[model samples]
Target: MPIYQAPVRDTLFVLNEVLGYERYTNLPGFSDASGDVLEAILAEGARLAENVILPTNRVGDMEGCVRHDDGSVTTPKGFKEAYRQYCEGGWMGLAAPVEHGGQGLPYAVHTAVAEYMVSANLALLMYPGLTQGAIAAILTHGTDEQKTAFVPKMVEGVWTGTMNLTEPHCGTDLGLLRTKAVPNGDGTYKISGQKIFISAGEHDMADNIVHLVLARIEGAPEGVKGISLFIVPKLKLDAAGNPGERNTLSCGSIEEKMGIHGNSTCVMNYDEAEGALLGEPNGGLRAMFTMMNEARLGVGLQGLSQSEVAYQNAVAYAKDRLQGRSLTGVKAPEKKADPIIVHPDIRRSLMTMRAFNEAGRAFTLWTALKSDVAHRSGDDSDRQAADDHMSLMTPIVKGVLTDKGFEHAVMAQQVFGGHGYIEEHGMSQFVRDARIAMIYEGANGIQALDLVGRKLGANGGRAVQAFFKEVGEFCEENRADEKMAPYTKALKKGLNDLQAATMWLMQNGMKNPDNAGAASTDFLHLFGLVALGYMWAQMAKTAQGKLADGANGSTSFYDNKLVTGRYFMERVMPETAAHLARLSSGAETMMALPAEAF
Candidate 1:
């Protein structure tokens, strides 16, 4: 059984002390999000996650989602009721607009709330997570009527949301997708296509499922230029504004996968389904990105949440398990053996997981805070800078977090040795579950390509440069802090390395386009590690200040933050050195291999 306590207190430290949620709350559209309100909301969410959602996870996994012969899908037992609890508690609409029945909280607070659920039950939480993004897209790009019709239900959790991007033949390459939406005379379009790997695609968790689909408009253009987004409801709407007639969209079947089986990953069939355009015709990819940005961040949280949960279990197990005498000689000779924590190797594995999980949390919260600035800042220039920074960081957040998150999970499992691999120990589930995050939401490799080939140069390289400038300011301001010296040094070194790599790539890629594709992955990870280290430093400074003021009491939390920050600086941050070195190696090193090299 995976027992997950919401790291509520720790989350508060990150939000209130580290990120200064107080100032963030003062941002436009978030005036009501005071520190008290944020804490109260997170506390309520923590209780629900611990008492309601967490308990259902093992049950959901063991039961999984059922694919009925009649073409319906059934989520594991207790999910529907739990989802109802989530909705009734206003969980789904944490960051949605107040007019749409949402609480209109700051995205940073919601990020903390979601951390609890995802850590407790990611498979189950995906139901509402996707819904939140769907609601965001419709609200941002949909016609006024679409918002009036769709936003309320999604916010109320009466209907769930699904993203329809991947097809049988396409994942990241939208240009290759063949799904089409033919305009009909009566205003509604006819969407005809098959979309695969749709999470929460077909489930009984809600009264309806709203799919924000991408398809080609007839004769619009070839490739991605022709792609457009549509709003396709599983249940056709009635005149009374209720779900009535059956829509042409149907689930052909659901997928059986290695993990996340609690939610149905389905093959959807849209046979001339009546659909409405989300935005201007032939402008769907741009519209779909409204949803993608949110989904990408949510997916990044999945990585952070799972790694945290896995770390908790591994630490508990390490402190309890008795093992052979430590190499330094056992202190527990009177007892049968020393607890595993006495062993240096076990400590290394457990500490590695902790280092990544803590840094990941800080990085994610910082990203969420940036998202808050991007959406709510009143100053146009400030908002644009925030958005640019966000655009630059999204792929790193999604790619590096998921990639490293899986590593932490596996490393945590290694703490349990054989027990981690065995099903009875409940450790393997974390590894199995975290695996898909890397492949989905645009595969990590693809995310790297997007970071290097596109976002880095968006608006003429200003976004990437502005990002470094902000980090430089943070480092310069805190360079003299007693506990922050190493952090400043590590962060500055990492930033300089990333900048050198960026400059070298631009100078080299001009002559060889192939160089960008070959080095993107390493470069992306290098950038991600540096960003995480920057965040870890921020966390350490905050924790140390709190301890100086006698705020943390006798707990090890503050000391642990300092240790983990140092560990990350020493171990994980060095990864960038290797990656940057590899970036200088020509693409031919990888491309030169024969097709049948094996």
Candidate 2:
């Protein structure tokens, strides 16, 4: 069976050392996450992930989710129990506001723990993951009554939540959605629509489900301008605020998907379900985006989580599986063959996954810190800067991490040879599971377009310009440090490539919109490479500092960190040039073919 061990120590390295998480203690929740407290939380989270959640992964995939004749859904075996334990442990609201029953910790701390949970069993985690997004939406955009009725229960994990936006005909285009809502004489409306591909849509784990539905009101304008968000619960609330009457909504059917079988991806049908408007009328897209943005970040972490678990298993397999004699000589003559890890090609794959996972973790935590700053900072300028960082990086995180996450899973699977393809080894499951992250929460292509078409130019390019300045300053600051030379040099090159790509898009994209469309993905990837390269440079600097300070007898860990960072700088950062080249070539050839040519 495939095994997973959360890299708690590596997470500490990123949090305590690389990101200097303690420096932000002045923030609202950061003060609560003292080093010792953070360590204890991660240790406990790792224990749960390893001891409880990891064991259920293969079983969940094997069992999947089942839908009954009554329009109710059952998650894979052990899921309900696992979820109960999760709630009892107070994990569901690790970072939620204290007024709403959470621990009131920094979002960075929550994100760090979430990585472990996701790596343990993504399918199981989705139940609460979607709920967190819903809680965020209601907290951000919902009215006082809506927040009072929904946020506490969802945060407590008694009531899971989902975002219902897609219909049978509409996925990304909200304007095409046909879901309708009509005033029901009171404040609530009667919602009638069908939404497809809703994860954790109907499940037995929670007492209720709060659905944030998007629909158009009667006599509302056509297209997206008419859309409005609604809070439609599975069970209507009583005057005392408990689930009372059944809502007119049911799971029509569950989707048979490529992976994450343990998650109930349902087709939901609403027959005049009672729902309250979440925000202003005709402002549904704006409100729902609050959930979508959070979900996108969570999905990005999902990519990293899968890659981390897959890498762990692949490394274990490579170390144990004996294949051929070492190229150097008979290193393991007593065993008749050396371990496959002795092979250069196998080492190459393992190193690549390792490099990406470590830097990816840093990248994620960095962004999570920005999120905390954006939401919690008292200064308007600080909030704006942090928000800009979020808007700029979210797409890259969702797009690049997932695209690479799936790539690494496949690579990890390849290390097992044909054994990886079979069901027994469980490598296949990782490959299958990681595939969805690239496609969901606004497909990677759409994420790329968002990065290029919207984010890059927002606020007169303030965010992108700030990012360039920060990275350039880092490179310049470290130019004289010999130990940091390798990482800084490579990162500088990658940053330059990213800057050139941005310039190319600005110069050529407006002249031919297709140029922007064709170049967006590459540009996003180029941005991701530089961003990760920046992570490696920072990590290298920190590791070198620790080593110089004697590393407190943990020299090996710091040494290994430097080595992995060097590998990324040498082998991976160079890919930025390729992305830059492809993007600069732009639209002419890509859009040359006629419509019927294929």
Predicted structure with the largest TM-score when compared to the true one? 2
Q: Which residue pairs collide, candidate 2?
A: none
1-598, model 1: which lDDT tens digit per residue? 7677888887878877788877765685566767677778888999999999988888877889888888898889899889999999988988888998888878887898999999989999999999998998898898889999999989999999999999999888899999988889988899999999999999998898899999998888988888989999999888877998989989898888888879899999999999999988888888888888899998999998889899899989988889888888877878999899988888788778788877788888888888889888888997898898889999999998898779889988898889999988777888988999998888889899999999988999998888788889999999888678878788889988999899989988778988998889999999998888888878877877878888547448888788888988887788778988999896977888888995
Question: How far off is model 1, as Cα RMSD?
Answer: 1.5
Clashes of each: 2, 0
Supply the TM-score for candidate 1. Answer: 0.97
lDDT of 2 at 556: 98
Model 2 lDDT per residue over 1-598, tens place: 8898889999999999999998898899887878898899999999998888888899899999999999988788888888999998999999999998998899898899999999999999999999999999999988788888889988899999999999999899889998899999999999999999999999999999999999999999999999999999999999999999999999999999999999999999999999999999999989988999999999999999999999999999999999998888877878978999999999999999999999999999999999999999998999999999999999999999999999999999999999999998999899999999999899999999999999999989999999999999999998999989999999989998999999999999999999999999999999999999999999999999999999999999999999999999999999999999999998999988899997
Give the Cα-based TM-score of candidate 2 against the true structure.
Answer: 0.99
Q: How far off is model 2, as Cα RMSD?
A: 0.8
